[model samples]
Target: MAHVDSIRKDMVILEKSEFANLRTENEKMKIELDQVKQQLVNETYRIRADSKLAINLERSRVRVTDMFTDQEKQLMETTTEFTRKDTQTKSIISETSNKIDTEIAYLKTLMESNVLETVCNLAASVFTCLQ
Candidate 1:
């Protein structure tokens, strides 16, 4: 009977040790689960922030593109206006040049006619005086 009781006591001690080890493993598993949950929360926050930033970046890009498009349109309009003005100025200059040429030719004819009339009158007076 004494030997049987000692064997029973040894069995009891082994059971307690096994129970303690199981409890320690359970605690470790719980801690690992908590860390995983925290990491998931942090990743979710980062994803949300990145999504907001991406939206803002897209908006800014659109605004800048619109501005560039407007500038391109304005530049095209300015170029067209400059070309029209240049054409008008060239036409005016050509018309003014034609007018100046006409006036110069008329003045030259008038001076030549006056000189010939004066020479003829002098010749007639000399002929009459000789007679």
Candidate 2:
């Protein structure tokens, strides 16, 4: 009976030691879980901030693109207007030049006719004098 009591006591002590080890392991696991939770929170915050920044950057890019598109449209319109005006001016100049050329030709024809009439009168006068 005495030997049996000693063996039971030894078993109890071993079980207690194992319980303590399990408790220590549980405490370590708790600490590790807390660290993991903290890391997850930090990562979540960083991801949210990065997402917001990306959204803002995208909005800015869209605004700049819209502005450029508007400017390009305006420039194209201005260029088209300038081309239209330039073509109109060139057409007016060409029409005026043609009218001037026509007037000059008419004046040259009148001068030639007057010169021929003068020569015929001088010949008639000379012929009368000879007679």
Candidate 3:
């Protein structure tokens, strides 16, 4: 009967040790689960921020494209206007040059005619005075 009592006491101590080990394992599992949950939350936040940044970048690209298109159109208009003005200026210069040439030719002919008439009159007066 004394031996049976000793065996029973040993069994109680073994059972208590097993229960403490199980409690420690449960605490470790809880800590691991909390860490996993925090990692999931951080990953989700990063994904959301990346998505927003992508959307903003796309919007900015569209705006820049629109501005570039508008600038291209304005440049084309300005170039066309300058070409038209250049053509108009060239035409006016050509007409003015033609008029100036014509005026110079007329003045040269008039001067030659006047010099010939004066020489002819001087010769006739000299002949009359000698007679």
Candidate 4:
């Protein structure tokens, strides 16, 4: 009976040690799981921030493209208006030059006609006096 009691006591001690070791291992695994959870949360937060930044960048790109398109339209309109004004100015200058040329030609013709009439009258007077 004494021998049986000693064997039973030894078995109990060995079972308790095994239970303690299992508890320790379970605690370590729980700590590791908590660290892994925190890492996952941080990574998720970083991904969300990156997603927001990408959305803002896409919106900015769209806005800039719209602005550039509007500016290009305005530039085209301004260029068309400038072209029209330039054409009108050229027409006015051409008309003015033509009018001046016509007036100069008419005045030269009048001057030549007057000189010929004066010469004819002087020749007639000299012929009559000589006769």
In candidate 2, what residue range of length 10 has the lowest lDDT sum? 110-119
Model 2 scores what on Cα lDDT? Answer: 0.60
lDDT of 2 by residue, 5-124 (tens): 475566557656755675566567557656655665565566556655655666677767775666556556655655665566567556655665675576457546645754565576
Measured by TM-score, the strongest candidate is 3
TM-score, candidate 2, is 0.45
lDDT of each: 0.58, 0.60, 0.59, 0.60
Per residue, candidate 3 scores C-alpha lDDT tens digits across 41-120 of: 56556655665565566567776776566655655665565566556655755665566567556645754664575456
Off by over 4 Å in 3: 1-62
Q: In terms of lDDT, which candidate is stronger, 3 or 4?
A: 4
lDDT score for residue 82 of model 1? 51
Q: lDDT tens digits, residues 19-109, model 4?
A: 5675566567557656655665565556556655655665667767775666556556655655665566567556655665675576557
- Score residue 3 of candidate 3 by CA lDDT: 58
TM-scores, one per candidate: 0.46, 0.45, 0.47, 0.46
lDDT of 3: 0.59
Order of quality (lDDT): 4, 2, 3, 1
lDDT of 1 at 14: 61
For residue 106, what is the lDDT in candidate 1?
58
